[model samples]
Target chain A: MSSTEKHIVLAENLTVGYTPKVVSEKIDFQLNQGDLCAIVGVNGVGKSTLLRTLAGLQPKLSGSIQINDSNLESYASSKLAKELSVVLTEQPASKNLTVQELIALGRQPYTNWIGTLNEEDKKQVQESLTSFLLEDLQYSRCHELSDGQLQRVLIARAMAQNTPLILLDEPTTHLDLYHKVQILKLLQELAHRKQKTIMFTTHEIDLAIQLCDKILILDGAENPFGAPCELIEQKHFERLFPAEMVLFDAKTGSFKVNK
Target chain B: MGNLKPYRFSFILIFLVLGLAWLLNISLGSVAIPFKATFSILFGGQVDIESWNYIIWNYRIPKAFTAVLVGGGLSLSGLLMQTLFRNPLAGPFVLGISSGASLGAALLLMGASLITGFASFSFLNDFSLALAASIGSFLVLLVVMIVANRVKDTMALLIIGLMFGSITAAIVSVLAYFSSAENLQRFIFWSFGSVGNLSTQQVILLSIIVCVGVLLSIISIKRLNAFLLGENYAQSLGVSLKKSRLIIIIATGLLAGGITAFAGPIAFIGLAVPHLTRQIFDTMEHRILIPSVFLYGAILMLLCDTIAQLPNSANVLPINAITSLVGAPVVIWLLVRKRKMLF
Candidate 1:
């Protein structure tokens, strides 16, 4: 790659797990600006652990993670907040917050001491509201929103953070197929249009293959990192599951039930 | 992100109501001072009766100020607790601060007589009572802070607080069983709760402690707002969880522990005032909430004190009874009518 295409996240020989037990190790990946990436693996394969480590929510077992040309450990929390943001799988503690207020929380790092939103902060919040199609529901309490709408609101909150990189743990988990695709496509548009590097963990491998610019498949060993077609061409998806249960159809880029 | 202009009118109205309630509270004591006389006395003007002037300055004014501080401090701590734990049911005393105070006062009132045979300490003043309660609450607060540091989960901390409450209550019960009748009576009266009988120095001390607590809460406005997203998200937003939690707990200790120390464990106001303020404000922002809850709490305390005085009657009801009698219904009615608690 050229120097102009900056690497937003660079992880080398990364190991992630709780202390005294290793969940996933030897993971290496680099995401450039404007890349929409996905981490796809079977359940209990430490996909969320990997994302959590990358987001600095937990300590990595070993290896170096760099964000925006600085070591992840080097940046102060407030400074790091401007470089990356995250969308969690768990619901917010208080759903009594309005959609607008929740999204405005994204500007916390830039807000004044008492969290008064300046003109720029308000502008970013408005832009995020517009992007996520949440304008009509800005005043609506989060508890009143549907699952899909709440998911959109969450992603909007991360977008309003205006970081160079975004990491989400299982952004498509509870949604139906259409809504999953809608969220992934929205994330794709956000990445490309805003030149933000986005990464998320999901079991929606088939959808991720169709929507993402890059895919990191964690298969417990020799985790592969490449384009979707390259991953499919190498038959990585074929070995993802037991052949007796399901099979990968590389022709149409999907999984088939072995009936 | 919108302007606060919309809530400005409500804030002004609430301030006026607080003033009215303060006037009403001062005027309706056993002496039956007129509202006009009370108002004139407040603004440094003279009342016709010399004794009435003495009553207004020396007694009712201090009592009303104590009520304001007790109510405002406890309610602010309650708001802090609710937000910090992310639980609607959390109150200032939820962490066993008042229970500790009770245990402290119980030991001083009953246990002392049980050991010394009631003659040596027959004349127990408010000073000794306040001092004992403050020590007890401070000890409990210290233990809670130590436990809070070790425990990672907020819910677990809440459970630990309740455990502390239970432990202290059992000790108080044991002490109450062994005491003499006179000592037991004093203890019971202390538990009934009061905002009166404080000297000028004590009120000033309570005011200083409450001011420190309020200042801490004000400083924590940003972190509290970020916390509405929960801990993980709040951390990602650059809030230091340990630091914020410590500041909030210390603020709660000062407000709940200190007020319970001075006011003899006044109940219900700390738990209900935040919810009541939320009924009208309709927002979760702490910048609006801290001041709003304080005003509402002060107003409620004044009104409750007025009713407890019984207006021209010498026999005063327990302020604790009046608070529950007046407050529980209003909260229930508001929740029933609104169909949801804002928290």
Candidate 2:
């Protein structure tokens, strides 16, 4: 571990869920700048709830979440917007917006009151489009893009937001294997190059192990957090699901169907 | 931002068309005033006919102004509702603002005579009717705004608004059934909707209300654009959801309610003008959309009013029928040809 590295995110015994019920609790994790992390768990294990809690989309039931050494709840919404951006599972309300217009919307925090994009804002949007390989589709309406292209556009929008931390919920859902790897690799590149702390929740355990700088295994308890090799050495993935259904193979960091 | 350049010419053309349409609306009414006379009168030049001046000043000009305010206000509120609710079908009347006004008008024209046994009291003038409708719509808006604060789901708020419309509509029908035939006819005339009867004072008041609403809409342009991505995303963009929602609701209420009170619930213009404007201005930016919708609606209203008066004829059709009859088919044809609504 790099003892001197600055931590961008720190959660101490975090508890998260809806108002009436607790989905998960006693969770602990810390991420340094430029780390690309994944939270993987079985269905209904509060993976999304934790991410939403961290994004300030929902209030945590208990425990503390600190972003850049400040309480997550301390920053005003407008101030928090400058610190983090989120990509969710829901599609945009209007598909009629062109790709360029949609990306420009991410600059809402820094733009004028009427949301007129200044030269700097325009430059960021252009850079995001180019880095996300979306320049060709910039003029096309969002409805015209394929699923992979739309996902890229969404992430690019978050990039244009120019926040220090980015959160995504299932950014690779509804994509084929090649596309999933492409997106994860792109996210990895974005975090390493831009020095942004990026985190996402996914069901792709194998890919997460392969590409993520850090892996958070949400098993409803013990909620192990560390590098992939450490997690594998600790046998956290083996306990992810019931042994009769699927077994985790530590040799290749992939799961196998038990017969 | 550079995308706005291509749409500049379209805006200028629409503005010119709005001017021409305003002129046409003022000129082509039941009386055969020549276009030259109309243009001269409009520019402070005089024609030889004295009564023509009276008709133009006292009757046609106020009606034209009312048409512009009603059409532009309704379309602007419709655009706001569509963006706020993120539903293509949402309009100014979706929150029952028009229906509330209708209930108020119905009570004034019919229920008062039935309840008091006075057979339409002398105190209930056009101004009083407008006041009653305005009060009713304000009450409904207050309730809807309260409900909007409590309900986190926008779809639920939309459904609740629909229920409010249904409840008000049921009450209006009950009022209609027990009233006398003369009272029923009075109520029917009010419901038929006209842009012709507003006085100069009422037009000035309406202009003020619409201006306030337009100002609120202008302030909301940034938040409205964020809302095109849905409420959660909008909130993440630092838009205060509850505050912006309330502001948008109040804006829609003032525009829709004030217009309905004066013009008596004209239909189709509020529901269809935004979609029609989208045919030309393809972007979803409200800065362009708000103005484009206002101009398109003003032009369409002028054209519709001109047709309802039927150009030099004594017969005048109901403006509501004219709007729907002329507009519904155009929307249908556009949707069919385009294979989808741009929303």
Q: Score the docking of each candidate (DockQ).
A: 0.75, 0.71
lDDT of 2 by residue, A158-248 (tens): 9999998999999999999989999999999999999999999999999999999999989988899999999999888888899999998
Error of 1 at B180 (Å): 3.2
Candidate 2's C-alpha runs over 4 A off are B116-123, B138-166
Report fnat, model 2. Answer: 0.62
TM-score of each: 0.95, 0.95
The sequence of per-residue lDDT tens digits that candidate 1 reaches over residues A1-259 is 5778999999999999999699999999999999999999899889999998888888999999999989998888888889999999989988989999999999999998999889999999999999999999999999999999999999999999999999999998889988999999999999999999999999988899999999999999999999999999999999999999999999999999988
iRMS, model 2 (angstroms): 1.1
Q: Write the per-residue lDDT of candidate 1 for residues B298-332, one digit (tens) a residue.
A: 99999888888888989999998998887678768
| Top candidate when judged by DockQ against the true structure | 1
What is the DockQ (computed on Cα atoms) for candidate 1?
0.75
